[model samples]
Target chain A: MSQAATTIYVPRDTTTISLGADQVADMIQTSAANEQQRLNVVRNGSRGLYWLEPMLEIDTDRGRVAYGPVMPDDVDDFLATECWREQAGHPLYLGLTEDLPFLKNQQRLTFSKVGLIDPLSVDEYCHLGGFEGLRCALKLSPQETVSQVTDSGLRGRGGAAFPTGKKWQTVLDTRAEQKYIVCNADEGDAGTYADRMMMESDPFALIEGMTIAALAVGASIGYIYLREEYRLSEEVLNAAIRLASEHHFLGDNILDSDKSFSIEVRLGAGAYICGEETALLESLEGKRGMVRAKPPLPAIQGLWQQPTVINNVITLATIPTILAKGPDFYRNFGIGGSRGTMPFQLSGNIKQAGLVELAFGPPLATLLNEFGGGTANGREMKAVQVGGPLGAYLPSTLWHTQLDYEAFATVQAGIGHGGIIVFDDSVDMSEQARFAMEFCAIESCGKCTPCRIGSVRGVEVIDQLGQRDVEFEPDDPERLAQKVLLEDLCETMTLGSLCGLGGMTAFPVLSALKHFSEDFD
Target chain B: MITEMNSTEEHNNGWQASVKRILTELKDKPGALLPVLHAIQTEIGYVPGESVTLIAESLSLSRAEVHGVISFYTFFRSTRGGSHTLQICRSESCQAMGSRELESHAKQSLQIGFDQTTSAGDITLEAVYCLGNCACSPAMRIDHQVYGRVTAEKFDQLVSALRTNVIEVK
Candidate 1:
């Protein structure tokens, strides 16, 4: 038998690609060819460590040693020494890939196989316990499968935090000859990249999870409603779907069973409102992505007036782990109602920004100070916007807030999609507040007046507040009146808007006003 | 006004066949409107006003309905852009990283604001929310290629090279 060729890994994830991983990969290939080196070059997904991206790894007799932030010019020197195999005298060497403090400290459940496998290769995916969930799922009846998910205590990771199993039960209970499972990949949030990372790194997990969902609900067809901006994710997902189909993981009968399920990838035109479930359904049905009034909820009548199950990319991707291991094992990881680990995207002005997958009860301070290693420019971290454009801006005083959904809600904040965007002391909270309104105004679907018009008015009011002089007394009636008016506007938008786009828009504005009032002054 | 209408008419004359072909290929698919519009934009560089009537007829929808979808997405360009398009990020994360300064530099260098094309028709600058590379803040996309940690100097070099047609924008 021939000895297996040594593998050198370089990531093709979009963030890594943006940092010139493609050029670095090309250089390595050229250098290897020039030297006639008989090693295999494999393009893997990111390890969620964005700060150390273009992170290249080499398989050695000991383990996979790491080298990173590698530019094309550095490749010639790297190849000359062949120090990537061991932690030789190379300055870029970081010993074992998994031993890095940023990755070693966290728990990775949903993202276990991410950055560790060749995304396009089903063989590599299966070798690392990929399809075991679907294999176990196929053996159970639909009711039993739903119960397993229900027992796991898994909730929607797409900001709402609704119980995932209950949503599935509704679709399962509804009497329909045809039902649908839609994976919401419209990750339009500004500070979030977990959904995009999972889809790019381990797409088959999403596909497998959706297939398991179809099995649980007795659905025959599924769709992944993806955002338009994610061109790389679309390419990777389509390739993974095609491969899954050939392997009988998707389409027709499953692994010699009588069940039949098929999935398609549908791209959403740019619209933030579509991240709202009902509006997402509207867009998926080939109409304007306007928010639909609930009660004839999507599970009752959705996608051609049939039952449907819609879940976020993270929620669906985490299912494989829940099924592979038992529900108790998954449930044991978190605190309170929140179960399992979430992939937190630590971004913005931070020294070590990346995806940190941990259990639900970690204080925000730990993630910001420890894993994140404080502000990127060595300035003080003044505020952080958790969730997305619509989430609250938490000040340093509130940094001790735990990450559980209920805990975040107690402080009138939300752990929306687990994205925390840090800001340095140089940031102007007044400008950030104005941008919250502006973003809503730009992305609103125009179906609800409060969202469509109130956002525009909100922008005007914020600009007026900004124009007030700093010399004004704390109790100045004219300034106080404007503040009262702004509060009134926020109240109207929060209570009156049809969906979260406008309703939750007030969270950031009010949070900024409450926590960072000096910026407004 | 007469000259403007005549030139628009001439432009429509050039795109009619390709628009028809795209609509014909994608009309049968379910929820075909978005995909059809995307194909037209890809093939013709923009969704021309003249093609709206043809698309509406082919897809059995009203002209307003077709136009509504076209105008809804910031991605679908109604008028023709420059030979190359540069979309700069203005979202919160990027803002925290001096994107406001980058935006100003781009506008000053290109002599155009967001969504405006240069007089020479060589470059168009537009504002986008996020490119999903928040860790490497101050990101921008020229055509479909995303570049990150863009300083004023890097922006100048890229834009100048693109203007001179020294590097392929796509």
Candidate 2:
């Protein structure tokens, strides 16, 4: 065995960083240097098995071996130059990294190079089949590029599941003085970090994806409207953009072709309403993030009154691979109309909370049971909220529902951003229902009266329902009538509101009431 | 470690020149107001109420318009906070992992509500919806550093560490 033949990987993902990967990396480097060792310490992005971070991975002859949930104290023996090692004796060791069932079971398509490579290394990115999609896109006509994506059955991974090709084709066909491609990176959902992961881990992929979109839709300039909460992402993305520009992946005349495109990373202040594409555009234009009435979609007129394509970060990031491999190759992975894999986020009260990218059609039970390892406190799992706070709080009865958008819709649930937050048996469903209303009231943009007024009324009615024995004023409705009133308020918010902030806020509240009626009574 | 708020007032003395530097650097960029405001905040703690007029003039927006934009978002603060801004995540995932109890513990230990700084002027607590550290739930961010899997005891230790560190820095 060669003495200098080892590379150590420690994740630089936000979660891992918070968990002390930096300290672990520093300690390992110091220990290695003390032993006169020649080792490469690469800060890679996360593989999404967050529970095992600061997970330490080493390059062995067999493959990458994993050891982790490692503390700085446990890193000393790693650099003990005994000509390599035994992991079975180590308490933190978890055998070969890929062999772990959690990672082994996942169908990681977009996240292929996340924890394996330096996110900003354009050279490493190219070696791992990175910009092959953009190269492939460069050869095809813009119209043909759009056609191939349509054939791939790729829809927006950003909850709405809009047909990506249709959105692209609109911009392609539009007659415009200027055009824009805006990537919605404002990932505000509580349990969802897939966008952040993809951006942090393999940013080149997103750049490549956006470049392909630029080629497809004839957009010269792109803007990544990232949220301010993601400080790490801002740093990573800006560095990646500079590197991409230096390498000729971005800027005027890409790869010496007639095509020219550029990208800018713009940060959004804290407003959940800005996740809506129109509101995002308004924010990009330095206006308040209020939802606009839809008749002219963002594709028709967006970003300084020009043709635009506004896609979610994940949706755009998935573009490179689809073009690299073929429509059929990507299309073969998923079931029915929900083509391709989704990075399903499992968080909250689960034992093993992390990102699990799977082909569509897996039952929710699979994610909750096979991937999540059940409840964290060894308690019975009572409910799970699929999607964001706006999504439904599903009971165990609906566990059989597939992860597909259509399947979720059948059960009055939306797989919105593919985030499933688990709740244990001790949860008060009435409180959960009330929280949905309260959240709506807090985040409402006040563009419409129904959302602004109805949400506050929704909270009042739910509170009244919870305290059924209270003496009612002459004007106050009875507990049973209050329940009916809450339902009516939710309906108004769902139908009358302009965007998902007001429109879909009813999903969780109504679902909680429908599934856990006993909690209300 | 408890310091008076006078230091913040003293820091504000140079803010006019600081705001000018920020305005001169970023005012011409596309959609410049947000970036300019963010820069001023980074350089001078929060967006000082007076700087709004300077920003408005530079960006060619009315004072009311600039203030409207600032007030629209929870992140853009008009007043200067304590030495550090401590934002605890209150979203669903964190709540499910016992952030509510952690939040109450934080309030009790610090003797302050959300959005209110203590008399010491060393720590300011705020409630944020999410920090995207859901996997290791019950998360909080102090300045730009996000910490996860935080319990009541952990919160206490973190504050104590911050207190000691801030004293050493000053």
The lDDT leader among the candidates is 1
Instruction: Look at candidate 2 and give me any clashing residue pairs.
Output: none
Kindly list the per-residue Cα lDDT of model 2 for residues A77-133, writing each as its tens digit: 555533235366677889999999999999988888888898988889999998999
Per the 3 Å backbone cut-off, how many clashing residue pairs does candidate 1 have?
A: 0
Model 1 ranges off by over 4 Å:
A1-4, A468-471, B1-14, B166-170
Q: What is the TM-score of chain A in candidate 2?
A: 0.97
**Can you list the residue pairs that collide in candidate 1?**
none
Predicted candidate 2 versus true structure: per-residue lDDT over B4-72, tens digit per residue: 333443666888788888899998988898888888888888998977777888889999999999999
lDDT of 1 at A283: 82
DockQ of 1: 0.65
Docking class of 2: medium
lDDT of 1 by residue, A1-521 (tens): 26566688999988898888999889888877887776688999999888888888999877788997777677777787875556567888888887899899989999999999889999999999999999999998999889999999999999898999999999999998899999999998998999998999999999999999999999989989998888899999999999998999988888888888888888887788889999888888777888988778788898878999999999999999999998999999999998899889988899999999999999999999999999999999999999989899999989999999989999989999988999999999989999999999999999999999999998998888898545677787887888888899999999999889999999999999999999988
lDDT of each: 0.89, 0.89
What lDDT would candidate 2 get against the real structure? 0.89
Q: Which docking band does candidate 1 fall into? A: medium
**C-alpha TM-scores of all predictions:** 0.96, 0.96
